[model samples]
Target: MNAQTLSVPAAIRARRTVRHYRPDPVPAELLDELLDLATQAPSAWNMQDRSIVVVSSETGRKALSEAAFGQPQPLEAPVVLVFVAETAAWEAANTDISAQATGSGAWNEQFTAMFESRAEFHSLRDRGLIRENAVKNAMIAATYVMLAATSLGLASAPMNGWDPELVKQAIGIADRDDLAITVMVTIGYTDAPPPHPGRRPRERTVHTELYAG
Candidate 1:
């Protein structure tokens, strides 16, 4: 099926966790397109902190499966996407952001100086906050990938039950202190679709104006 034929609502509704997948490999061109769309997802200060590693080789898949506590999805799917967050992205992005702002005639010298000062202070004094924000940014991109894959008639399963340290080692990034393994998403064609367990109603989840409860 063509991705252009699917509406956003249809894609969202059709998406399901696919634990079993066919042996066919996802085409490289399609994968690249999907990733490009996934990158369109928003990030704080346009930092674009998410980094993805595509694992398709049998050896790499085997290692990732072990890291994921022997989950078969990693081995069964033709491609496993590992999303990592660069916690230092904000620091690296600050200069370019200021440059772009200036180039676009949106730059405020005083504001830019204050923002950089605050960002540096947080990086040095509030490391935990920076890491948390980076993880959130990465997850947002992962969600986009899942939805885009679904629109392209591919199956996907997002897994979080893996040991972070093991995953880093499996992906050969164990020594990268600036990066955090955020999540893993397995994507491919699936013969069996997981049952839709359904979602909670808005009344129970959404709150209007203020929290009534």
Candidate 2:
């Protein structure tokens, strides 16, 4: 079908996870608008810990491709966006700490009060409900970005099939372990419509109040 024949609804429904991408370049403004739209995603308690790093340069894309287990899509796509979450951002957003307060001791009590409900938060980095909440929020933000790309006549694929540590290093993240790379999304034009992954019917998946027993 011709471009004009494809309706907005059709485009929305047709967009899919594109693994292979053409070399065609995506306009800088479009990428900016999509990322800007993604920032609107709500975070846990509105902390907005989710941060995005957009890679548009050929050299940067190559580095990301290496980090992503040699996934050609990262290099081929006009844009590769890395979603990162600063674990400490939650605390930093709530209370501004002076330069003097910079250790496990200095902020231990602060975080203790913040994530007291979860047992995992006592020692683990991202194992507690509070950290889980951050992860969920970051995923939601990436979803907004994907859907926005679909709306803007673009195809996108969100992939987590890579080494997080390598990605952090390639992206030049200082504290690699503290900031987690939640997801990676590649966006660009497509030569062919992607194969559909059909969804389940609403009746089977949705419940009115409680689940059927």
Instruction: Give the whole-model CA lDDT for all candidates, comma-separated.
Output: 0.86, 0.75
Q: Which candidate number has the best TM-score?
A: 1
Please name the candidate that would achieve the greatest lDDT relative to the true structure.
1
Per-residue CA lDDT of model 1 for 1-213, tens digit only, reads: 363646689989999999889999999888998889888898766667788999999998988999989999999999999999988776653687778776787757886776566565376436557887888889999999999999888899999999999999989989999999999999999887888999998898889999976
TM-score of candidate 2 versus the correct structure, residues matched by position: 0.76
Off by over 4 Å in 1: 1-4, 100-115, 118-127
Residue 110, model 1: Cα distance from true site in angstroms:
6.5
TM-scores for all candidates: the values are 0.88, 0.76
Clashes of each: 0, 0
